[model samples]
Target: MSKISAYILFLSLFLLAACDSAKKEFETLKEGEILLDINTEEYSLNGTVLGKTATDISVIDDVIDKPLYKELCDTRGKFLEEALGNGESIDIFELAKLHVDDNLSYVDFYKALSSMYFCGYSDFNIAIGTNYKDVFQLSIPRTDYMWCGLVIQRMKGLRYKYLRNRQKLSLSEMSEIDVEDRECVEEYKGLDLLLSFYRKDDGIAYVVSLNETFFNKGSRFDGYNFYTFNNDADLWKFIEDIRSKVDRQIGNMPGKKEDKVLRLLANAHGPNKVMLVFQKDVLMKDIAPIVKKLNTYGYRFAFDLD
Candidate 1:
């Protein structure tokens, strides 16, 4: 045989092997179950890694390591806009499947699954463990409108965090966070309005349902305490209240305005996440000042829905 012929045969065999491997990975995924594998050191779905795919050129505009999460919202929002034209609602799973292009990676697909809660697809049965064999087929019962459940399984350290309804949440759980026996949830009722999972040192997952009392009396959870704010005035008043509790000279130290403010605030409230709860009538213009101040001084803030 000629050298060129041998080389061509070898190349063809290699391509066939790669295609077979990709097919097996896809076959491992059951209906309604998303497999996000981190065994390749990068987030991979089936055999496609986010940055390794040709379609990932569009992801260059996104933040580092956060491209999928950002794209999850952007892509799903556009899909919802087109799917629900002049209609009140549509089947989420069907709409999602239709919009998923051949170029979509598994990481983006899993992130998209998590983003479904934003479109009111809340009910989910999440199970995270070491390998794909531990993942069960997600069975969502039919609701009055449609089926409303998704099962997400993380094979390894895929750094995806589902921030429920908020742009930023300090308490949100990242997919890679260690869990013995993947005890996050056997059957999470739903990621309804304010449902959150708080895992303690003892390895027990606590289902926290934040409500009006969280705003009125602040949150004291997991050995951390912090105040909540409904508006900019509430934030400033809390600042002033913190000032009153500390020594005047210390709180009003010269050349240390931001540091003094943070120190006193931390002293009054533990060094934990500060909650910002905007009332229904409050506009962005109303809370802009608070957000700016928090950003200016590097405050760890968490915004919650009313």
Candidate 2:
């Protein structure tokens, strides 16, 4: 074919393909759904028809809006007193220390922690340790980004739960928003679960690849541990095995070393960190349960924010 004719043919094919793509996108969008084409890399969007796109977004640490904070305190004031001293004035962390066990159950302590976290005290921290109160100091270690990130995500969840009820958005509309829950904060039982299972010197990070059919487990970034789980039961079993080994190791340690190990485990950068590798297409509904389970073990979750 002549050059001019070949160029014209290529243009026609390009237009045809573009039209086909547009048709597919249009078909997937429902009547009430609006399509957005965003180029900035600061926002991540998850939707059924639009597909999923993740970006390098920092967790928003904005204090809960005053009106909503007031609403929360008003309705849950009695519950709030469990953590906040006198239900109003006092350093919350100091107050938490006083009731570390006297008045607070593990569950209740976490509830108070969540209240304080959402109430603008983002410095509060937790970790896998014997004394949970020791980890609740105002000076959270700078290395504990995973724990901080989890709280931020939990706050995001709470904001959605509270505000959505007020806006009265339809179920269909609500589904589009990725509302990770506040449960991870309140439901965390790291101290109760005895999750200090790794040797303090080992420095192992459990990075799990959440696949479609199974989970790929890795102890180091160098390679996978060759352990794949087709079910949650197997994953729990593997963790138990690690715990058993840790117990044996601790039994053999000198008393001084054992004490040192305990102190090390309480630090935020300790062995209780897990990096969950998720495919972009994975839904938050599927991710939430696993996250909650991990939180129960006092496992701080890290993600590929990049």
Candidate 3:
């Protein structure tokens, strides 16, 4: 074939594949139903289609319940036991003494350290308390990028659930608009489950959209997340890193979900908080192992679908 004809053929194939990529991810899940398949890197975990959206998907993860908490407490405790690499217990009161680096002033260092260690994750018993006063708050210092000039590590599963108190921005307002022109995002052409790690002003955030992002035109979610991270550079880097990944498989595809559906109730909190909605034959399952796969890659979900 001539060079022009060869190029035309390749372009046609690419467009066709791009159009079908989103639909194909759905087809892969429904061996029968929208059976959820948590994807780690090794394989796909299949389950009935629990919840879906115009351009996103979600599976159940129940690492927040008590029985499961009881089951994993020893393991978590063991991890805590090895805190700071010294295998010593860290008391909350002594949190101000943590000296992670030279640049971190004692006050800012303590604040970051407290954000990491305080406000109980294990205390959650299917419901999040109504007050942000008790919630763990993270501060984003000025930086060239998300963490470039800041001396901090983004925490996985970290949440800034204060969206309930903040005013809700309509989908159009919250959408990430390109100042230059209508954004033509490079379509995600892979069938891999879309999981992402993000840095927000309030804390590190995680998102697992079906195949599109909150900013994608195809994404029809009515919700919008509140942002306190005023650093434009940081926000740019966060979204760019997600959009530019060579592949979206952030971790090993999860296997089977265990028994019981562990839930975190931001009870009084408005239900519109969750961006992706998913459900299944109700009951808690072992979310720890599957969640660990995402955490290993630094994506942790903190809210729930009520």
Candidate 4:
């Protein structure tokens, strides 16, 4: 081959490779608003990329085949707009009372929402786990009028150290309970508040049903303990089943011993999705049944192994 021709061919290949790398790292998405038609191995969904990081992108838009404004959002669409519009400033700590105007299209509502808070985005369509045998179909919804959940599991059993010259909590403990978990289970100032967030100007919101909150509180010792899913019998059953399998595996381990209580923290997400942080090592198969069940029910999962 002639030197000139060979050099041209090598440059073409390099450009192509660089383009592909940019797509994977989402560098291409940062150029402008990108309309992505995604079919990830886990699920299929569409979104518009509004922002990007070195490894991830922000979904400022959701694309769906049908209108889910009514079935998806428990409130009237107009109410949602009023909550955000009204020409009034938003207090991220307010009760989020419903009050306002009569109409706003689904697209406009979401546009306003994304402008006010980042709660409106989903993590694109990443699979629950990296590798698994089962394949569950995907039915991604337009969450314009709806909310999605984020589960942050922390299993570092907590304790109440009464006194010893007004001892303060370590930074790690504070981070786990306050910052990492989004203050879901918090002792703010002095009040024990089992707070559930729906909108945030500087933080994130994870929806929690009123019934679920009452149930979690009922299961606690003094409205401040994290216990099993007492009200969610079916969910608890699935969790216990997974726990049984993982427990047996731990039993077979040579010299490992229990350190603290087995903690699983899942902030109630919009979909039935959850994020699990574990006390012991767990294989994909160990939790396959529930994971598959959730997938079957149109749910997704993300885990924190650290």
Question: Where is model 4 more than 4 Å wrong at Cα?
Answer: 1-133, 136-271, 279-281
Using lDDT as the measure, the top candidate is 1
For candidate 2, what is the total of clashing residue pairs? Answer: 0
Which digits, one per residue and each the tens of the lDDT, describe model 4 over residues 99-187? 00112122322222222223222323222232212433222234433111221212122222211122233435545554354344333
lDDT of 1 by residue, 195-286 (tens): 12222455422122221122222332111122334344655565544434334433444546557676665444432234444332333333
For model 1 the TM-score comes to: 0.23
Native-referenced Cα lDDT, model 2: 0.35
lDDT of 3: 0.29
Model 2 regions lying over 4 Å from their true place = 1-141, 144-224, 250-252, 261-268
Question: How do the predictions measure up, each by TM-score?
Answer: 0.23, 0.30, 0.20, 0.24
**Count of residue pairs whose backbone atoms collide, per candidate:** 0, 0, 27, 3
TM-score of 3: 0.20
Query: Which lDDT tens digits does candidate 3 get at residues 10-99?
Result: 999997786566334433421111111211111111322322211121121332322222323343455455664774545421211111
lDDT of 2 by residue, 32-54 (tens): 12222212222111121222112
Better of 3 and 4 by lDDT: 4
- Sorted by lDDT (best first), the order is 1, 2, 4, 3
- Indicate the TM-score of model 4: 0.24
Model 4 is weakest, by summed lDDT over 10 consecutive residues, at: 93-102
Model 4 lDDT, full chain set: 0.31
Tell me the spans in candidate 1 whose CA falls farther than 4 Å from its real position.
1-36, 45-47, 52-65, 85-133, 136-306
